[model samples]
Target: MRRSILSAVTISSLVFALGACTPKPDQADNAAESFLESLSSHAEPGEFTDNPDQAQEEINSSWDSLQAEGLNTSLNNVRTNGNVATADFTMDWDLPGDRNFQYQSQMTLTKTQDDWTVRWQPTVMHPDLGANQHLELRTVPAEMATVVGSDGAALLQPGTRYRVFVDTSTGDLQSTMRQVAIELDAMRANDESVPSIDAEAKAKEAEQVDGEFSLLTLNQQQGLDLKNRMSRVEGLRFNEEQAMVRPDPNFAPDIMSRVSSVVEKDLEGSNGWKVVAATSEGSEVRELGGQDAQTAPSVDVSLSKKVQDAAQAAVDTRSDAKVMMVVMQPSTGGILAVAQTQKADEDGDAALMGQYPPGSTFKILTAFAGMQNQGLTPDSIVGCPGTQDIGGRIVANYNNFSLGNTALENAFAKSCNTTFAQVSTDLQPGQLQQTAKQFGLGVDFNIEGLDTITGSVPRGDVMLERTEAGYGQGLDLASPFGMAMVASTAASGRMPTPYLIGGPEHRTEAQGEDGNQLPKEQLDNLRRIMRSVVTSGSGSGVASAGEVYAKTGEAEINGGSHSWLTGYRGDLAFATLIVLGGGSEHATSVTNTFFQNLDGK
Candidate 1:
């Protein structure tokens, strides 16, 4: 009996000791990994959690409130104290706009029999969270800045807009056409820049369209007026919004379109955001983290509202031809205005982009080449015949005009085609093209907010082509913007880097770089030669507008001619073109009106 009792006691004691041994190291680690995986997956923490419902609720709430695109979690370090364990974990929340938020916190788990389960607690999600606390992400909007012009006045201002629409299939589309047309006509009358709409045409086009069709967008006051006018009109709808708009739509329409795209993002400043602890009602309970919104600064552009208005008015005077103009500040190379008549607008950005034969204007470059490469001065005598044969090509002045043997300045003023043709054909292959670059032609400018191409002068290796190019006909092509640069160069005696964005830091070098400044003696002589054109020659039409030094050109095409005038007065340099508008006098007349309008202001 004693022996049996001793054996039972010893076996029972041994079994008890084995049952109370320390837990396996991988036991708590596996449980922590399982809980983290569930939380990161936004799934229910079924077996690994003590209170599965609470754990699942908190996980889902956090994911939604934080607007997390994705969540990743990891088990950091675990410490076991008998049946209770503390596991350090990290949660990485991926937010919108490529933002990320990461935090390290501890989760509590208790061993129940053979299994370890996570405990339900707000601190398990975030160390800063309290009981019944919720997580939230908040955003603050930023105010956009206005674009200012050279006059330091708002050019493109932030304004309230309403994009008005109509469901063509919802109402009597055909019957309502007249009223809509009347309303649009009223808008046009109020703001002539507002495009005219054809209601009947729109109705006809919407015949097969069963969806919404946008009619027009109006400003706050204009929208109010429209609402009052179309209050009872069925199928009418509006989308309220904010955007940048030109106060005077007639002011440099082409340039405004180009500038809007480049400056749109820059106008909206930094937006503020915050992560906060909130209540069930979505109100802030405690501060978590975030940055305040920063207001965007004003954007200054290299344009003058006053100058633009004048230029637009001047260009509008011509309706029979496609007329365009580009004006720049000679001293700074800042664009002042771009203006185009109705016909020119139809051709798309011709004021700064249309490439055409530049006629007598090519003589300007040829004459410069003569001075720079051929040792010809303004006082040198050059021959001018009614018609001259060079390189087997016959070059003649307009109507075969002739000025037999005259001073270089006189020949230039008279626009003697033969004289310039001879000079151009006599030069080395690359001489003319190189000289053109010195005057801002044949180069490219990556001007912020402006898309422009300086004129092109091909290698004049072939004598016949060079002869024709010298007279501004054969392979020569230039836009109004290019000619403006040339005029500005002559005005300042060096090529000024042109820019649309005005600031100390935004200035940049133009493409196809080369020598910047030209010889002062030659430029001075060139200036004198240009002045003679206005005082007594082809450009005399604009002579009343002060000492307007200029060059007049008439490019001959198959059926007609293109008129051109490029020059400067005071600090304003400009170029004017009239497509198929015969005679340089028309261009000179247009230029005179532009200057006069500026003065009248």
Candidate 2:
């Protein structure tokens, strides 16, 4: 009876599979060519213009530039069968002067109007020369089974599981199979192993595979387990059928770099030297072999689409100069999007990566540290004259604002530099450094694609001079990224790890040699003080973000204009920097634009 049931089920499944097979290769190719033609119609011509002769010349110039390099590419054959245009080309492949054989590439070009373009293909360009030597242009079948969320988005959001299958026919195509295996091997080298679904084939093979053994499996045993797991679930099967589990390409690039970045930054000297691969989604590194996992995701702060629209509008309002804008999610440290006009080559990224003097923003850190070290509340009274001498240097309050004798909180609100400098005299040098370090100063928080500058702090007897450093003076240089770290640390009640990408859970196998965790009480102290700075401090000028904690700075760097605003909202921390290429108005206007757009989520 059992044998009868198994046979019946197997026969029924085979009949169904035969009926639902994917489209024929020729049909798939036709569909892909048609899609490419449609895409070419909207392809923006890139840098191409109305002048046909100029466009052709530009293409020749681009090719000439490639020829100047050691690698050579020549078009040998071109054939068009309907929309499918195939081009065979050879490249003179010589690596580091050794004579290597030229390779042939078969390219399918979809003709849209007069120009034949390679579409939906991986364009391989030599890294040093920046020349496209070959392209394997093929249409990805529309029926290709892909995992999507309930809403049909990519399987990127949380709680989404993907299906995996191994195509037995792939083994027959040696070149394609080997290439696929190589790519998968490179991906699995990362600590965050993407799970695979080819267990059944593995059980029969005698030789060991190169990639993540823990992830891939054979079809019989593992496939049965996986199939059973999926069969038990309702609505989890592919909308079609026989969809194989492959690493989604979109996530592959991010996952490949995610772990490596962490190992490069945090674990550099020790076992990091031995690390073959690492994974970092922006900043948080997924350590392999049970190493220390990141406590938080890296900060990804970019303009939302709505804000980008607003920023474009703002740029349109201006004609002569460029407009640069940045938007950041204070919570989770994720940069949403970065948008800018063509005029500004730098973009408002200078606001984040550019280093500048802190000016008065330093007062917030100073006052917080002084108050904390002295065991003095914000209301603790301190005297302030128009000017005071500290470490043989005379410091005057901003605009010489004198509060006579007043509480520290009132002094802070008034932006009285004299009171702050005097208060700094009480705290030792070690105390101030410790305070700054807590705010992620003087330490590298690895942000991919951006350079970070750790603002300066005095080494020794500058403790008297250190008071001025508190008021955004005396060698304190910081980037927008650094300030955001300070604010996020203040907001999260701990330093939340800043990152750009998310997902693929981090597994910590073991703690590092330094076994360090951000102390709870220290984070609390930062929160309390930073909260006060926003509610009733000099930063109140920019406190329109509704119950936000912030600090503002206007630094004088010789002749350059640098203004700063750093703040935190809930778990989100951000810093906005405005640098004036001309004057202070540049800084102030940028700041105003930033605050004007700060409608928090």
| Candidate 2 lDDT over residue span 1-601, tens digit each | 1111010000011111344566433332343333223222322222222333433343333223222223344545555587666655554422221323344544455655654455322222222122222211111122222232212334221122333333433233233234334444544455234334233444334134332222233222334444454453322222222322323332223222443343233222222111111111112122111122222222222224344444344433433454333434545555432333445444534544556677766666676677567776666778888888877888887577677998766676556778877777678776766666666665555554334354655642666567767677777777666666666656654444544433323221211112134455544554555566657765655455556676666676676556556665554455555454343234334444544554532
Model 1 poorest 10 in a row by lDDT: 5-14
What's the lDDT of the predicted structure labeled candidate 1?
Answer: 0.83
For TM-score, the strongest prediction is 1
Clashes of 1: 0
Poorly placed runs, candidate 1 (over 4 Å): 1-138, 167-169, 173-182, 195-216, 273-292, 399-401, 448-450, 502-511
Candidate with the greatest lDDT versus the true structure = 1
lDDT on C-alpha atoms for all candidate structures: 0.83, 0.46
TM-score of 2: 0.46
TM-score of each: 0.72, 0.46
lDDT of 1 by residue, 1-601 (tens): 1111010000011111245665445477778877777666665654568877766777678778988776777676787899998988777776776676777789988888989888888888888988777678888778788899988978898888888788887878776766877887878786776555677887887776768888778777777777889989898887889888888776776677777887888799999888888877787888777768897899889899988888878878897789988999988888998888898889887878789999998788999999999989999999999999896898888899999999999999999999999999999998999888888888888787777887798788888878988889899999999999989999988888888887765775677756377888888889999999999899999988998989999999999999999999989999999999899999988889998999993
* Model 2 misplacement above 4 A: 1-331, 337-349, 503-537, 540-543, 581-601
